[model samples]
Target: MAAAPSGPVGPNPPVIAVVGPTGSGKSDLAVHLALELDGEVINADAMQFYRGMDIGTAKISVAERRGVPHHLLDTMDVTEEASVSAFQADCRAAIRDIHSRGKRAILAGGSGLYVRAALDVLEFPGTDPAVRERLEREHAQAGLRPLQERLRSVDPVSADRLGDARRVIRALEVFELTGRPFSSFMPSREYFQPAVQIGLDVDRDVLRDRLAGRVHRMVDAGLLAEVARLDAAGLRRGKTASRALGYAQFLKVLDGESDTASAAEETIVATRQFARRQLTWFRADPRIHWLDWQDPDLVAKAAGICASPASVI
Candidate 1:
C-alpha cells in the first residue's frame, strides 16, 4: 500500500472521515469543512449512492453543497445492487484525484461499514455458495427468525445491529464460509485511513425532534412524488431500490393496501430504527473523534484533533 500522504497533519492532503447517524448533520459538516479545507466530499452512505433517492436518503443538494466539490452522491441507479467493493473503487479514485490536485479528501456519510471499508485495510472473507445455500434453505423453511437466532449465536455484536433477515443471512454466510466471526476480518485501523474522524453529536431529544421535522419536510419536498417517479421508472417491487424506506412504504399506499398517513408513519418508524442501528455502528467504532453538532467550536475542535499527535505521529 502507498504510504499515508505527507502534509501539515490538518485540513490538507490527508483524509478526514466525518461519520455519524442519520439526522446528525454529517453531510452539511463535510461540505462546510471541504469549503474551508480545500477538500472534496466522498459519499459513504449506501442509500444515497442511488439516483432518485434524494429526499428519503437525506441527500445533499447542489445548492446546499454551495459549490463545494462532492463526489459519489446520486452516482448510481436504484436498480443497481451496489457493493462495498464498488464503493471502495470509486472512493479510492475520488480521493486520489483530489490528492493529485493538492486538496483534502473528506469522506462523509452515515454508512459505517462503507466508511470502514474505505478507511481500513479490511479483508472480507470469500463467499461460500454452499453456506449461502444452506442459510437460504433454513430461511425458507423457518423464516428469518431462526437464521437471526443463528447469527446472534455466532456474532452477537453484528447480529444485534443487523437485525433484519437479509442482513442476518449475509452475516451467517460470511461466518460459515470464513470459519471466523465477521468482525474479525475488519481493518486493523478503525477509521480505514489514519486521518482524523470528526463525529457529529446531538442531544437525543434534539435529534429526535429534528428527525420528526425532517420527515415532514421530506413529504413536502415531494418525497411521494419522487417515489412515484421511481415506480414509473419500472423499479421492481422487493428489489433493493424499490425497498428504499420511504418509497417502499409509500408504494403500498399506492397499491391500495394502506393509506398515505399509515405509510408515512411507517416510514418515520423505519427511519428512526435505521438511525438507531447507525448509532450502534458508530459507537462501536473507536476511530471517531466526537464533534458536537451544536457546538460553536466544532470546526475548531476538529481542526485541533487533526493536528494532534494522535493524528500526526
Candidate 2:
C-alpha cells in the first residue's frame, strides 16, 4: 500500500472505487452508494466513454441513475479515441472538485485497467504522436504480437502495466523512437490519493444466469436494430466501436455472414469470457474488498470500509 501524504487531507473520507466482473450489478450498487454518501459516480469503463454505445456498453440511463449525478460516461463519440491517461487526468480533477464541494466521488466499472490506472499506475509515460503514428503503421503491417514482444524486452515494467493492446502499441512506439522497450522509464510504483475499493461478484451459476437474461433482454431492446443503425452511420467492422460485444456479431448478421441465433450465441459467449477476464484482472489486487452479490448490507459494508481508520487505501 502507498502511504498517504502527511497533511490535513489525511483526515478526509476516502474516494471509493467500485469494481467487479460484468453482470455483477456494480452500477446499481454505485448509484445507491452515491445516494447514501452524497456522492457522484465517475465511470471507469473504457467502453462506456463513447456516445451512442449505450446498449452494448451497458451504460446507465438517466432513469436508472435515479437522479444521482454521474460523470465521464458519454463524454466522447465513437470516432474519438479515449485513453487511460486522459481518463486519469479527468478523474483526478473530478475527485478534487468533489472533495472541494464536500461530496464523495464514486469510481465505478468492471474495467480493471482503467480503475488501476486512475488509482496507482502513475509515472508511466504519456503517448508521443510521432512515435504513435510509426508504431501504428507497424501494427498495421506486422501485427500486435511482435510489438508486444518488443515491449516485453525493453519496457517490461511499463508493458506489464498495460493490457495486450496498449502494451503492443506503446512498445512499438518506444522501439521505433529509442530502439528500446518503453519500460525503462517506469518507476516501481506511484502514489495516488487514498481510495477504498470494492469488487462485486456473484456465484458462477448466478452470474451466468444474469448474463444470459441480460442478453435476452438486449435482444428484445432492439440491440440488433442498434447495430444496424451504427452500420448505416458508416461505423464498419474493424473499428473499435464496432468491435463491442453484440455489435460485431450483429454486424456480421447484418452483412449476411451469420444468422440472428448464431450472432446472439457468439455475443453471449464473448460477454461471458469478457466477464471472466475482468474477474482475473481484479483478483490480483488484494486491496479490493470482495462482496458477495447476495450480501444484503453490501453497500453499508463498502461505506464502512471507505471510512475506516486502517485504510492504507
Candidate 3:
C-alpha cells in the first residue's frame, strides 16, 4: 500500500475532483490519489448510481478499488431516476462526513452535470409533476418537433444547446413552472466548497481507439447478459438508465431489433460521441488542471499537486 502524504500545510484542504471524458482513466486516478492522500471517493457518474449497471458504466470492481472507500455507487434502483439536486445534497453530506473523520474526499467520474452539481454553487429548479406530465404527453402526441419549437420560442438558448428530447422537455417544463428561462439558473464558475479539479487530457485519436476497445471489452465481459438481468429488473422502464450508452444499444439487441456485433458497433460510436461531449463540457471550466492521462508517473504527479498550495483553490 502507498503511504499517504503528510497533512496540508495550509488550513482546510479542498475536496479533490478527478474529472475527464469517458475512458480517460478517471476512476483509476481517483483510486491512486485516494491511496496517497487518505481519501475516500464520492461518485459523480449519474449512470453508475444504478445497482446493476456495472459493466456498461465501467464501474470499478471491488478488487480494483483496493480497499479505498467509495460512496454513491450502486445506490439507486434501475427504475429510479437520479436527481442532481438530491445528488448534490448527498455529496455535500458525504464530503462533510469525510472531512470530520480527517480524510480527503475525492469526487470522481465523467458526468459533467453531476460533477458540477456536486462541486459548484448550483441549484436545480423545482419541478412540477403536472407540468412535466403535460409536456411529456405533448411529446408523446406530436413528438419532439412541437416541443422543440415551443422551447426555441421560450428559451432559444437552452433549446439550441439541448438536442435531446428529454432535456428539451425538462427545460420547457422549468420555464412553465418557474416562469424564467431555464438557462437563467446556469451556474457560474463558482465553487460550492473549496475544491481542486484535475482533468485527464488524452489524445483524440488514442481516445477513440481506447473507447472502441473498451466497448469491445464490455461485450466480451457479458454486457449483454448484464443488460438482460437489468431488463428483467425493469430496466426498460427506467428512463435514465435505458438511455445509457451501452445499455441503450444492447437493449435494442435484446428487443430483437439488432444483434450483438451491430449493437457493439453502435455503442462504440455513441460512446465516442459522448466522450467528445464530455471533453467539451469539462474544457469550458477554467479551474481544471489538465494532466496527460498517459503520464508515466501520474499518481506521483497528482499527489504532488494535492500536497501543494494550489490544491486548495
Candidate 4:
C-alpha cells in the first residue's frame, strides 16, 4: 500500500472539497481524508442541512463519522428553506474556524451551486420582494410557459439552463432587479480562497445501478417513516426541503397517492437523473482533480493531492 501523504502543512491550507454525484461515496472518502489529513468535514450537501433528514439523505451517522469533527449538518429545521447565500456565509465561517485551529477544511457534497459558492469567487444578487412577488403572481396567473418565454427573451443563457419554475421565475426576477442577465452573476473559475476540488468519477452504468439500489435501501431503512415524521413537522411548508428527491416522492405515499414500492422506484429514477445533472455541472469545471471512485488508494491519492503544493489553486 502507498504511504499516506504527510498532509498539508502551514496554518492556512487550501480548502479541500470532495464533489461528485450522489451514490459516489463522497462522504466516506471525505471522512477518510479528514482522518488522514487531520482535518474537519464541512457539508455542502444542501439536504443534509435539515435536522431529521438523515435516512433519505444518507447523512453520515455520528458513529460512521469515525470521530472526525463535522460542521453544518442538521443545522436547520425541516420547515425552513435552505439558502445558498446563507450557506456561503456559514461555510466560509466554518472554513475560517477550521483553518484557525491549524486543520484543513474538507467540503463534501454534490450541490454544484453550493460548492461553487464556497470555493469560487461568487456573489449573490439581492432579491427584491416586490419584483419577486410580481413575477410569482404572473407565474400563478399565466403559468410557467409565459414566464419561461419572458426569461428566454431577456436572459437566454439562464433560460436554457434553468428547468424548474422556481428558478425560471428567479431568473426573471434578477433581470428585472439588476437589468443584467442572471447568468452574468455566475461565479468565474477563479477561486475565492485557495482551494482544491476533488471530483469522483464513476462509470455511468455502474452509477445508475448503484443509485437504484441505494434508493431501495433507503426505503427499506425506513425512509417513508422518516419522511412522515418530517411531514408532521411541517416539511411541506418548506419550499426547498419539500422538493428533495426521496422526500418529495415518499410524501405522495403518505398522501395515499402512491404506494411504497412505486415511491421507491420514482425516487430511484429521480436520483439517477439528479446524478446525471451533477456530473454535467461538475464536468464543466476545469479545476477539479478527478479520481476513480473504485480506486483502492483513493484516500491516499486524495491526501497526496492535498499535500502537493501544486494542487492548491
- Give the per-residue lDDT of model 3 (tens digit) for 142-227: 99998999898999899889988889988998898889999988988899878888899999999999999999999999999999
TM-score of each: 0.84, 0.86, 0.96, 0.96
- Per-residue lDDT tens digits for candidate 4, residues 75-125, read 999899788999999999999999988888999999999999999889888
Query: What is the lDDT of every predicted structure here?
Result: 0.77, 0.76, 0.90, 0.92
Pairs that collide in candidate 3 are none
What CA RMSD would candidate 2 show?
4.8
Model 1: CA > 4 A from native: 1-12, 128-138, 145-162, 175-183, 190-192, 237-239, 307-313
Question: How high a TM-score does candidate 3 get?
Answer: 0.96
Alpha-carbon RMSD of each model = 4.6, 4.8, 1.6, 1.5
> Number of the top candidate by lDDT?
4
Residue-level lDDT tens digits of model 2 in 85-157: 7888898888888777777788998877678777774645656797788777877898877776677776677
lDDT (Cα, tens digit) per residue for candidate 1, span 1-313:
2222234643334578898878988888787777666677888888888888888788888899999888988787777776787788788788888877878788998888788778777776677668778888888898988877777898988777776766688788888777787766656764444567778876877887788788888888888788888778775642467777788888887788987778888888888887888888888766678778999877656666655656641
Off by over 4 Å in 2: 1-12, 142-167, 177-180, 183-191, 237-239
Candidate 4 Cα errors over 4 Å, as ranges: 1-8
Error of 4 at 220 (Å): 1.2
Q: Comparing candidate 1 with candidate 2, which one achieves the higher TM-score?
A: 2
Clashing pairs in 1: 119-192, 119-193, 120-192
TM-score of 4: 0.96
Among residues 3 or more apart in sequence or in different chains, the pairs in candidate 2 whose N, CA or C atoms overlap within 3 Å are 154-181, 155-181, 155-183
Candidate 2's displacement at residue 246, Å, is: 1.8
Residue 3 local lDDT, model 3: 60
